[model samples]
Target: MKAIQISQFGSNDVLTYTELVKPQLNPGEVLVKNRAAGVNPIDWKTCSGGGAAPFIGDLPFIPGWEFAGTIEAVADDVEEFKQGDEVFGFIRFPERAGCFAEYIAAPADQISLRPDGLSAEAAAGLGLAGLTAWQALFDKGNLQASQQVVILAGAGGVGHLAVQLAKWMGARVVATASTENHEFLKELGADLVVDYKNESILDHVNNVDLVIDGVGGEVGIDALNCVKPGGTLVTLPSVTKDEVIAAGKAMKVKVEPIRAEPNCDQLDRLAGLYADRKLVLQIADTIPLEDIGKAFDASRTGKVKGKLILTL
Candidate 1:
């Protein structure tokens, strides 16, 4: 099968589209004929030798985390799916990654049926971002109805979905995005969209029950000020563990770092939400595997209205 692998980590130019033998399945794994692959910032970060995982591979390494595809075969122990089943999931991250290829052997436990009525492109967009948003809101934040939640980077891959899920949970959603996404976010059930560029988000929001922080930087620290006392602050790509702990303790706040895990049950629930029109996964653009570099660059602009997908 044709796969994009990096012989060395440096820049996007290092990602080479080359031919390699098709991977075979092991126990508890399934061979998927990938239909679409999701391009994440982590993929680029890993390619640039800046990710959390140690560079273990000699040269060529496949870098992709999630995919939506059809099952070509399954291991003996697999009982939940069969050949030809349409599925989607986040493959093991920062360890074994091959979703950028046309075929991959992934653990069956990680796979889930794609959201009903969603095309491969849409399903591909949901794997990481959807899980992060859903888990943060329900699993970590414990958000409830009548709560007020603020979603930083509201139009981003995870932020957009978080805004919708928080709204579905009956929370009043306040979001921050560029002026361009004001209407887009409002349509996604965000009750309030603040322009982070021109206005002061701190001036507009206070006593928020939960703050979902995707843009983790100095801004993440500032986000704590918006949350109500006892409110939880959830962040991805957190800078320092000790700093977060000390800040949370000083402010009498709860701070949680989010690293999204593969959960078929949560994916299934999100699928149902998509089928019911209660949620939507927006795709910013779809690129072929050959153009993976462009996709990676696009994701870092901090202006994407949605997720970027790579068509296998």
Candidate 2:
């Protein structure tokens, strides 16, 4: 099987496309022939000796956390999935799950079946960002219907999804993006769009019930003022979480930093939403598996509006 592996942490130069032995399945795992893999900031960051680099164990590691594929084989204990089942998952996040390869040994309990209508590219991109948005809004923020919510970096991979999810949950959605993406966000169900480049986000709206802070640090600190008293702010960037949290504490606002976890049940529900056409996963670009450097460079810019996928 061909895979993107890093023998040492450095830059894009370290990501190598080479042939390797297939992975062995565990007791409750399924072997999947991957069709697509999602490229995220964490993928590049880890390869550059940051992000989840420390948690990924030793060198010569595979660095992908989300994928969509078909089951080639299954462990005897895995009764939920069979050979030839189309599946997708966000698994072993902030660690190594090896989704970049053509084959993956994924835990059966951590994956969900891909619904009939969801494309493999869409399913591949849906895992990490989708789960991040879902968990940040519903799980951590406890956002209620009819309440207002503000999402920072609204045109981003997670932000765009958060806008739609918040709207679907019956919340009044306010998103922050560049002027060019304002209309795009509105189409995604954001009721209001604030231009972060030319205008202040605080100037447009305030006293929101929840704020999903995708852009952390000073930007996150500034957005803390937008949350209503007793409302929650869910911060997603781990590198700047402490600064945002301390700022939240000084302002008497509650801040929750989140790392998206694997929940097969929630992913299944998200898949149902896709199958029903209630949810949509935006794809920024799709690159071949051998062109990981291009995808990595694009994601590193932090300007890609939607998800970047690698086709196998």
Candidate 3:
């Protein structure tokens, strides 16, 4: 099998496409033949040696976190999936499950059946960003219907999905993006779109029920002011304890930072929403497996509007 692996953490130049052995299935795991893989900021961060996990892999580590593929084989203990089943899921993400390769072995419960009417590209793109948005808006933030919610960086990977998910839950959605993405954000159900470069997000938006911060910086900390009293603010990257405490005192709202976890059950529920036509997928581009290096460069540019996928 051919895979893009990192022998050592450095730059994008550290990643190379080379031949490697496919992962062998373990008990309670299923071997999936990759069809499509999602590229994310975390992938690059890991490749560059700037993540929370220890870099202890023997040189040449496979570095993909999410994918959509079909089952090639299954462990005897796996009862829910069988050979030849089409599935998609976030595979042991952040820690790496080698989704960049042609095949991966992951726990059966971690993979869900792909929704009908969705392509492998869309399904592959849905895992990390989709789950991050879902968990932040619905799980951690406890957002409710008929409330106003502001999403920072609303045109990026998680922001685009958060905007749509908040709308699907009946919330009034306001998204922050550049002028070029106003129409795109609006289509994703952003009732109001602010150009982050030209306008102050808080100038026209205020008293929000929840704020999902996809871009964590000084601006993200300041975004806490937009939340209503007793409302919640969920930060995607990381919010310092001091930031959370200050937000609580100044705004009278709860401020929380969240890291997404892989939940197969949640993936199943999300799949059901897709099956019912409630959720939407926005893909920026799809590259073949052999062209993963180019895809990585595009994702690093931070100008891509939606998810970037690598088709196997």
Candidate 2 error regions (>4 Å): 93-97
lDDT of 2 by residue, 1-312 (tens): 999999999998999998989988879899999999999888898899988887898778988999999999999999999999999999893234499999999988889999889999999999998999999999999988999999999998999999999999999999999888999999999999988888888898989999999889999999999888999999998889999999999999999999899999889888998888888888999999999999999987778888999999
Q: What is the C-alpha RMSD of each candidate to the true structure, in Å?
A: 1.7, 1.2, 2.2
Clashes of each: 1, 0, 0
State the C-alpha lDDT per candidate: 0.86, 0.91, 0.82
Q: Per-residue lDDT tens digits of candidate 3, residues 1-312?
A: 888888888887888888877777768899899999999887887777765336435556788878898999999989999999999998673234478988888788777888677778888888888999999999988988998999988998889989988998999999989899999999878999998888888899888889888777677778877777778888776425456646566766787777677888888877777777787778898898878778879988877898999987
TM-score of each: 0.95, 0.98, 0.93
Q: Is candidate 2 or candidate 3 better by TM-score?
A: 2
Order of candidate numbers by TM-score, starting with the best:
2, 1, 3
Q: 1-312, model 1: which lDDT tens digit per residue?
A: 888998777887898998888887788988899999888777787788866336445556888888999999999989988999999998673344568999989889988987459889989889888999999998999999999999989999999999999999999999999998999999999999999888867999898899998777667778888888889988776345457656777888898988788999898888889999999988999999888889988986867889999997
Which stretches in model 1 have alpha-carbon errors above 4 Å? 55-59, 93-96, 239-245
lDDT of 1 at 70: 95
The deviation in Å at residue 240 for candidate 1 is: 5.6
